[model samples]
Target: MSSAEDLQFKILQHPNPTSPEKRVELMANPTFGRVATDHMVMIRYTEGKGWHDAQVMPRGPLSLDPSAAVLHYAQEIFEGLKAFRTKDDGIAIFRPDANARRFRSSAERMAMPQLPESLFVRAVDELVKADRDWVPSGENASLYIRPFMFANDAFLGVKPASEYMFLVIAAPVGAYFSAGAVTVWVSETYTRAAPGGTGAAKCGGNYAASLLAQAEAKHHGCDQVVFLDAVHHRFVEEMGGMNIFFVFEDGSIRTPPLTGTILPGITRESLLTIAKEKGIKAHEEPYTIDQWLEDARSGRLTEVFACGTAAAVSPIGAVRTKDGEVKIGDGTGAGPVTASLKESLIAAQRGQANDHHHWVHRVL
Candidate 1:
């Protein structure tokens, strides 16, 4: 077993890093998660040994055993956040401490060993700082950072693996779902999570399960899929990739509550806070899909949007169901409240506006 004294990070400089000009060209229009940075952060974990051999090494393929427990049992979880080039030419991350807490919660849900909150944050900070240049400088451009943990023990039995690895990788990216308001397909046939499932966890399996539903959305010529609650199949839980928000003509806002069946997204929480500060009434109660359809159809619900790390604040132009489709706010590009909130959020993230919550962490 390794001691806490051995948890120090060993930094290794990449021998053949991408050139600055070429990197800039790549960042000009880099698709999400396709382009990688020069270096990454990795930490090893053994049940009795605790966490040891923390390193900042060159980004490359992982050499995992084919029989690794994560491969068979899917005992893995991940978190997503971004590093932005602030207005003062600095690099910062948004509310990573919140992400750390969520990561711990997910690790617990996945039955994997916990990576300390401090270690997780430090690993992310190290990688982002190492690849600071990858943080693009433009509207809607930033370095998307992903931190993940998985079982590393090469065993096939259905049990928790004693060996594990935590890694943080960065990629320069633009918008995740495209540039404008998106149309979502209501997934009545597929459910994202049950009452006591890992719906709250940011695990790969949850996403893997949603891919088919997402594919179905694409088949319907929709941009994303919105999932209903598992038990009743009534309430709006979240979009396949992000949290759903409903804005009313009365200027009130409501999002689905975190009832262990939906992800407690940091962006969703931030928007709620921002709405309150702006004097907009906001609530986190269960709102059904029928209610959404009725409100939109009756001119009560004025706008709908999805919030997350990748898509930021995206307006939902319309929703497609088995019955038909209805456009929100006359199928506009972006409504006033949506545009205002998105601008304010992005501005705060980029240091253009005040950091009310102190969520931004400066890395470089």
Candidate 2:
């Protein structure tokens, strides 16, 4: 196996790139995860050969054996981040290093070989550079990047596969949700993850398990679903795809703690750091659903929001449960604290504010 520094990416131009006029048409009203770029990056891995055959090639279908391990055992992991068109007319990816670290952590949990963080980051950088034109420039618009890995071994045994594939593909996207605040549905039927489960890992199975609950949320007329802890099913865990936070009248905020049952969201972490910098008194503690309702009804809870790579600081306008609905902050829109944190995070991501932590990685 070679050092991470020794791995070189082979760049291949797409023979049939999207025409500029069509690209403009696509970017004009890009929806979430709908409009894809022309090229993608791929890297192959084998137990004996390590990681090799890296290429930035045309975006297309993949060839997997019928008995591939990933198809049977669900040994797959993935990550999502965005490339922002900066205020200074450049391109930057927010916290690729953090995403890289999480990717390795997810691979370890899935009993798969870990790719070097440098290689993971370099692959994303290569793809973003190749499709820089796809990075949209506007409010709440950026190129959403997806980096994923899957077991490719043809063996169907109940063990870790020796061969794997890593890939990065990007899409130009607008806001994940429609304008204004979003309503949430709390699920009592399905739980996302239990203790010592894959809840902390960014793997596909975790999401596969939450699909039904998400559908239930849609059935109940809500924008998203919230899951509770598996044991008591009382304490709030996280939303289907994002982390939840609560704002109070005392100018303090609280979010559910990470006890191996919730995904440690990058956007959530950034908001916490920004809150601390602004002296907002943030606490990563557990809050129960009953307490959430009480706080909302008593006017103690000022605002609630969900944060993640895809959603990006969305305010929770109301909470819907079996009993009834609890409106958050008049059920209108983002409160002051939620709005301020989002502004700070977005400014830093787009290189319009002081990047005190150097979170943004410049690519162009």
Candidate 3:
């Protein structure tokens, strides 16, 4: 086993690259996670060998054994980030280092091999460079990057796997939701994560468990589902796949604290940092559903929004519960604060704003 710094990536060019004209057509309105680039980056890990066989090759089907641990036990973790076409006609990835660190944390939690941060960023950069043309140029459109790892041990067992596979794939995508604020449904039947659970890890099992609750949200005609804490089932934890933030009428914002129950979102962290730089008082405190409904109805809570890598910042207009529905700030669209924060974050990500934090990692 060697350090990730000692590894070199082998670039295998795509044999049949997509034609430029066809690429343009596909990038016109690239739906989320549908259109993938021609090449992918893959790195394998073994117990004794450490990380090896790193390559950026063609994007295609993966061959796994029938007894692969991930197939049965679901020992998998993944991450989502974006590569944006900068304002100067260049491409940049927003905070690959942060994502890399989180990937390592998730790996540790899932009992898998920890990928070196340098190697993680290098793998991402290799793939992005290989498919640079796939990066779409627009305000809302960017290449969505996905890095994932799964237990590859071909054995029937309940313990951690000795073999693992890490891969990075990307898709040119547009907005995750339609224009306008979204409505959310509060799920009393399903809870996302609890104390001392895998709620904080970005693993497949967490999402697989949320699918049914998300379906319940859809059944009630809402865009997303809001989950409460597993212990209390009253305090606001997080949305299905994103972190929730609340803006008050007094210009103060509060989001649920990371009490080992929510994913520490990169976008959420960036917003909090931006808020502090701008003198916007933001608090990470626990707020219950009763408090949320009461505050929204009493005109104390003015705006609400969800943040994540996939959706960025999406305003949550109305909240629907079994009792009834409550609208936040007229339930029309993004409030002034939400819109401003989103604009600032996107500007920094796209190289349109001053990058005081140097979060943007330029690949081209």
Candidate 4:
């Protein structure tokens, strides 16, 4: 990894840029993870050379060997964030430094070379500058950034790969769901994380393992799946790709604490900070499904929601099980607290409000 002062990224402009009309049409209703920008950022790392050849070039497919370690061993990790177009015709990223830190942690876990925070931020800045027009300013829309690292060594070995590639891609994404709030099902049959496992890391394998349970949730007429601990399947771990939170009627918010078995979500941490600043009671502790059901039935659990970079904050309608179902609140839509928190966070990201926390990083 290069030092902050020595960091430099070479730019290779794409010859064929997407037409303005087509880009506008796509941005009008840009769904999540669908359309992509014209360019991407890539950097390579090897055993002999630490990190080199940082470039921003045209977006395309990668040519990899059949025996690439990422293909066989699933040695890959990814980070998600967004670049929002502010009202002043400028763009800013939400907590990109935090994402960069988490990316380094993920790299350590996956045995991949960790890129310096300055380099990661610079890569994002360069790509966003090159594709600033792709960022959508429409309501609930922004340019999503995906930074990923993977093992690229072709040698067939059981140990970690000696070569790796780090890449960042951008996508113009709109709302995750067309509706106001989405309903999710509790996955009792599938466990997302175990004690002393890789749950804390945002790796591809964790998501790959939850696909089946997510499919089950979809089959059960739900938008997403909520997973539990692998040990007893009692404590709440997280949703398929988001963190879960429970709002109690006693004017307190509770979310499962970081037990080394849940992804330390950026949105989750941001919400906690906002809640504290707003004088909302917040607790980080374990709460079982049964307890949640009981509390909801007794009007103690006021609201349920999930948080992530993709879906800023989404209200969870109900939790269904084989025995019975627990419907939270009136199930009409988002609660007041959830709505307020979401608005504040979005405002900070979009540069619409005072960013007292200094969470937004200007990319251009």
Candidate 5:
């Protein structure tokens, strides 16, 4: 943990905060990433001083030099976590320390200075505390936290920048899948990550590379896109933004093993822990799309789902390709396995079930 003096942040209040009526209207139909809160947390870094000049300021535009490193080289990393308003009207964040650790991992991968875990967590906590009123209390509604670091050095050289900036922004969001369960398109054409790549890192470049495939999925009338192993294109990797799982009728659940190609999802890890506690068989191994189709046809595969911070656990009803489409479950509804897992996971997050894993971190 960083010392309190070292992690000190300058606080600045918003001059023109949103009114209650307007904020309520926005939260009533808040889609993902559409609106932002009044304030943002920021900290700057230099080669000589490391991370410094932390502040919470009004949300506005950034004035950057023409030769800013992030603009030219795309050196940036980010993380996503949410703060929930519990039944008792207290606020808590789900697995924020996990996000802090992953943020450091992404910083290392991007060749940027790592924000101290304590500072990162404190930044989120302070911002959420100051903006607790921005947290929506409706069902499946909460405050979304986005912490990001980017190179800010103004130089034309194609090397790692000597200066960087870390910022945290918040938004009140409704459920990611407000429409319901989604059908994902298996992207046989575009691969999300290679064996030796930034797939494991939560960097902007990896997501930029996935947008084309995601756009194609939308064109094909699908909600999300799933990628295969870049080398063989035979094994399942993950969705564009989520980790995937397959459940067998015998009560065994399988997810793709971490081959240094898949992002180690916090939600996926939590699900594994909960599944084991419930005596469900959970296996992490390489299973190809063909095997999944075959198992589903033979009545062995009972449920297919995707997991991430944004969507939590969404049942994958069908996997579509140019050749054909394979439906994993009986109908458009979540399977028994998916339902149980989703219920337990959501219950733990919402404070409805005992948090034996101690995954929830209280913010306010």
Candidate 6:
């Protein structure tokens, strides 16, 4: 990774940017994915020429070929991280370097050119700085940044494209979901990924494949769908978008291991580290659906939650399966351990607590 000083950015201001007052109004009650900032970052890559033409410009549509590879072949990848207005009125992004490293890994897996980690972070910083006013400081809001790349080739071949476009767009978003504990549906019908697949890669195709399962979940009155292992369909893997954690009354927390079948979530890692500091035992091991059902029914399982970049942490109260329902800890709301860990994590992100691991990056 190159140092911050190695990356230089060219900025082009937007002529008709949103005014401060209107920007504030949008941020006041921003939905999760609707509104975006005025400017965005763009970079291009060619097969041999490598990455070039870094620019921060106004947000707009792109012109692509009728036979663009991404439109058909789906050679695309993306990443999500956030910029926050810290408790002290300073802007900080939580562990953007981790996101950058993961972005490179995803590109390598998708057979695309790697954007240098420093360059990725620099592009994100340039865009956020240009639209710094769009960063929301509302009660449960922040600036959500989405960085993505797609094959831009106009060829009709099955091979990797020769050209690609990388861009960063940001939006001011409120909480990912309601604050109450969520209900999830377990899908025995569809599997997210197998042992050797692109499950760990943050690519668009993976998500595209899960939409049907998500719709099935909604049909059952559940907010998300839980996927089982592709082999046995017994072991609990993850939710559609977030990682699942099982918390027991014994003060032990276990999440599914990274067996190349689950996305390695950054929030999942941070909680494990913080759990250890709080004297909570954390394990990355397998726990099957049968075991989960038995434990929750017997009161051995105290709380369950999901973690990701968008929501940080969400308490899982009840799970609806074809077998029946499994409620955790009276099925109320966030549990003690869940609440404590979330508070610590969010506080660290906002610079309210001591950043012992130095994860917060103040780009401004």
Which model scores highest in lDDT?
2
**How far is 272's C-alpha from truth in model 2 (Å)?**
0.4
Task: Give the 10-residue window scoring lowest on summed lDDT in candidate 6.
Answer: 1-10
Q: For candidate 4, lDDT tens digit of each residue in 265-318?
A: 999999999999989999999999889889989998999999999989999878
TM-score of candidate 1 on Cα atoms, chains taken together = 0.98
User: Which tens-of-lDDT digit does each residue in 167-276 have in candidate 6?
Assistant: 99999998998979999999999999998799999999889889999999999999999999999999999999999999998989999999998999999999999999
> Residue-wise lDDT of candidate 5 within 1-364, one digit each (tens)?
2343476778899989999999888889887988899999998888877677889988899989999999999999999999988999999898889999999998888788888898899999888987889998888788999999899899999889999889999999988884446788889899988877888999988889999999999999999999999999989999989999999989989999998889999999999998999899999999998898788778789889999999888888888888777788764868888889989988888777888778888987
- For model 6, the local distance difference test gives 0.91
Per-residue lDDT value at 305 in model 3: 99
Kindly list the per-residue Cα lDDT of model 1 for residues 1-364, writing each as its tens digit: 6664447889999999999889988988887899999999999888887988899999999998999999999999999998899777889898899999999999999888777788888999999878888889888898899999999899889888999989999899998877678999999999999989999999999999999999999999999999999889999999888998999998888999999989999999999988888998999999988999998999999999999999999999999999999999887577888888898889878877777679888887
User: Estimated TM-score per prediction?
Assistant: 0.98, 0.99, 0.99, 0.98, 0.97, 0.97
Q: What is the C-alpha lDDT of each candidate?
A: 0.90, 0.95, 0.94, 0.89, 0.88, 0.91
Score candidate 2 by TM-score against the native: 0.99
For all the candidates, what are their Cα RMSDs to the real structure?
Answer: 1.2, 0.7, 0.8, 1.2, 1.6, 1.8
Best-to-worst ranking by lDDT? 2, 3, 6, 1, 4, 5
Clashing residue pairs in candidate 1 (N, C-alpha, C atoms within 3 angstroms): none
**Candidate 2: pairs in clash:** none
Task: Name the lDDT value of residue 145 in candidate 5.
Answer: 95
- Can you tell me which runs of candidate 2 are displaced by over 4 Å? none
Better of 3 and 6 by lDDT: 3
| Error at 168, model 5, angstroms | 0.2
